[model samples]
Target: MKDKRDFRLEIASIESAGDYVRDILKQYKCTDRDMVRAQLFTEETMVYWTETANEGDILQINVRKRFKTISLSLSYRGAQSNPLAISDEEEDETEFSFIGQNILIGLSTVTYSYENGYNVITFTLKEKGTNPVILIIFALAAAIICGLIVNRFAPSLGPGLSASILIPLSKAFFGLLNAIVIPFLFLSVIASIFNMENIAQMKRIFRILFSWFLGLTAMSAVIAVLAGMIYFPLQNGASTGVNEVNIWTQIAKMLFDIIPSNIFQSFLDGNTLQTIFLAVITGITMLVYKGRFPVISKVVSESNLIFSTMLDAICSLMPWVIFICIFDMLLSGDGRVLLSSIAVVVLICICFLLIVLLCLLSVALIEKQNPLQYIKTIGPVLLIALSTASSSATFAPHSMIASNKQGIRDYLANFSIPVGALFAKPFVVPVLLLMTLFVGNFYSLTFTAADVVSMVLLCVILSVAVPPVQGMGIFLFTIIFKRFTIPLEGLAMAASLFMLFDYLMTTGNVFSINISMLHTEQRLREKDKRVIVYNNQKC
Candidate 1:
């Protein structure tokens, strides 16, 4: 019938809570104890007592429970002391404000500060709910809307004004893109090659590369064929009598032109794809003969480092470059034309993404891995990729997840992702090429068998040359296909929509390639380990 005894205690540190709780409980270590209860508290929850306890006031003690051990500490304001508790009200205000500011600034910018007995936190708020990327998106949307409105309302003024506005923006975007492409390609390709040290490694790398190349080519061929069949682009209307330039002749001219009758002319002319070709050849030759010429080897090594630094600097500007590109594309009134074909491009992109996903699932199931687990492992990177639409930007996170989470080897992820970033435009090549064929048909431009081969070959070439960014593939597509009487403007229109889905399929490509490489490597390692175990057993 004895009433239960209670004790109250305080702890100096969360880390020492166990010892303090134990000592307090030892006090009630008596035979036939009726009942005992203990409650522990930290200063974090005891703000009122600390606040009210004056310089000399004995801190009021409360014993609501009894325990064998207890610890307590109290200090006046502004001293190095133990953790303290704040009342629910104070905690609520502070915690909620912290969370609110975090929401405003975004988690990436939220940071904490503690100084002079005061906790300070700061957050950066986007103006009018617009960050840089969002601002670009809005500007692009507005530009497109204005272009359309002006075109519909005042046709006479629209095209001229739109062209004037868009041309400059396009030029600037083109310049930025041009500046980045050569250096990026140079570093990415050379680094990828160097990452593969020997011929055996290169062989494996090429096997995967060839597989992807063939897969993309086959998919693009199918899409081009389907588009040709469905749209019957060439048979749609009266022949424009566009003498389908001999594909071979055009390719010969292209090859000749890329030799840069004058290198300076090529630079001034913004021949980026040509520049990439020249750079790759230079790098590969240097790599292949590094042993023969020490001087050339050293020069190449230093150049690679310099180029890598420059490439990094340029890449840091990619998000902004993409913004500028999107903005200019919108501002120039090109987006208005897109409205007509946007649905078609969007449908095509969705279908392409679905196809890539199906292919990824097939790879997963064949390898006896969980498809959903693979998807989840790459989910965050995929989201970032979708938002930013840059595969290289997704590289760090993708590599981390593949290596740390998915158990893929770091070397394989690092090597394969960059290489895949270079060549894996699964959707871009297929969709843009198909759209080009469709445009040709719409214009009644005869696309001969030669033209078809030309398109595929161009896609393959550009797939190799273009930096694997959001719209780079499409731009290259426009440059190449425009030679065949396909409207460059239509290709640009298709690109605008293609950019929206580029991230999804690019992520898919990275995921697929990484998983394939991982499983392949895992199987090889497992086989080697088994071999070693058997040899050891025989000994």
Candidate 2:
């Protein structure tokens, strides 16, 4: 006889367990009479043991085999504890056999237990690849397609529609151009002035400025000479046709006309040179009387602020204006002919980019910096300029890189970049000079030594005078050289070509100026004892 305990066993597949039990019973030769004293086990016991079992939990089974009588007992034991006993009636063959077989077969029973914790799902994957080379190629192709499509198809759409589109867009771009111009100029000039406040500072400033001017002049001279030599006006047949006006007389008129009759009228007429002169005078006056007339100085400061704010508001429209300008230019169908003349355009752009690269290398060498590193540092701004074709638009990014990454002082970058934007006419001066010389020679018009000097002088002067604004320089050049029979219409012809090259040249100029200024500053900081030495006697 065996004691019975209150327990229950639940089996989901009782038939399978029963079949397994019968086979084991047969092997043991146990009949109903022999198993009559044996205990029956339920599925609940098997589940409970498996669910509560830890890695070291163990099961103890007792089997009694006899010819006419059989008995079995089951119990559980932990590694550190004594085994718990079970009654003979509580020992069930089906439950014990099922669980024991699963343990032997290495079947796993998973029981989820959550304590105070969070479950986080993690995924492991492979790294992704980036193809910058392919991206750049695609971008270039897209730009070309855009240019071609706009140039070829926009004109057929008509002017009234084009104007409606372009005017607002141009105004928006022009607004953006306008907005930043004043603040950029004001901050830049003030920063420059502050940097060069003392005599020592001024000496260093002038030294750097002189070196920059010298380098620029050298580059301009080299390009001018090379371009002039390559595209000699004589290559085109000379015209002996009588002129409407004498060359000397025309030159005289140009000289007089440059000195504006009324300053206000100059601004109204968008005379950039005149406006620059006036602005410089005003800036100087403000500086001279800053402390003595505080009220006036305050007014000047406020005016600068006002101008900056206005300019910022205006510049907000720049992208729109640029789009419109591009759209209108393309829509006019002028670019169609220009596209057909792709060889000339490409040749000119390649030559210009070459010159620009050469000049940049020169600056990098002079500064003892890695040229490629410098190029990479300024790469983004250069790309922007390449796409936008406007140095004015690129100035913000250029200044930022110059100041932050290149370790140039904000004051120096702000001042040098904007002033450089205005004065560094790398493409404009060289191309205009080359074209003028070429045209003058083509007409068999023999220029005097004085006339040649005058042309160079004009190029230098206008280059400095032109503000960093689109169409401003071109318009000024046309007005100034109209009397010289330089064919103002040629400006229109060159404008398309100029847009492509301007990006490279402007980027080059900005980069060169930043490096030059950095070098100058470092030299000054390192050699605190040396006064600035000038090789040329010129101021």
Against the correct fold, how does model 1 do in TM-score?
0.53
For model 2, residues 1-539, the per-residue Cα lDDT tens digits are: 22222222223433343344344445565533222212223233345454444554434333444332233433444222211112234334332333222221111111111123311111111111122223333433443456567556664555775667655654454344433443344333442232122213335454675577556655765666565555543222123333334546646754666567796686555443444455566556655654466465444444543454344344333233333444455556544433544545554465566666776676566667787877788789778766655454555677678768877765555455544554556556665665566445533555543355446556666565434433443333453454355543334334434444565656556655555566765765556544333323334
Residue-level lDDT of model 1, residues 502-524, one tens digit each, is 65656555655565556556665
**What shift in Å separates residue 315 of candidate 1 from its native position after superposition?**
12
Clashes within 3 Å, all models in order: 22, 25
Off by over 4 Å in 2: 1-203, 234-347, 360-364, 390-411, 435-453, 529-539
CA lDDT for candidate 1: 0.48
The TM-scores, one per candidate, come to 0.53, 0.44
Best by lDDT: 1
Indicate which candidate wins on TM-score: 1
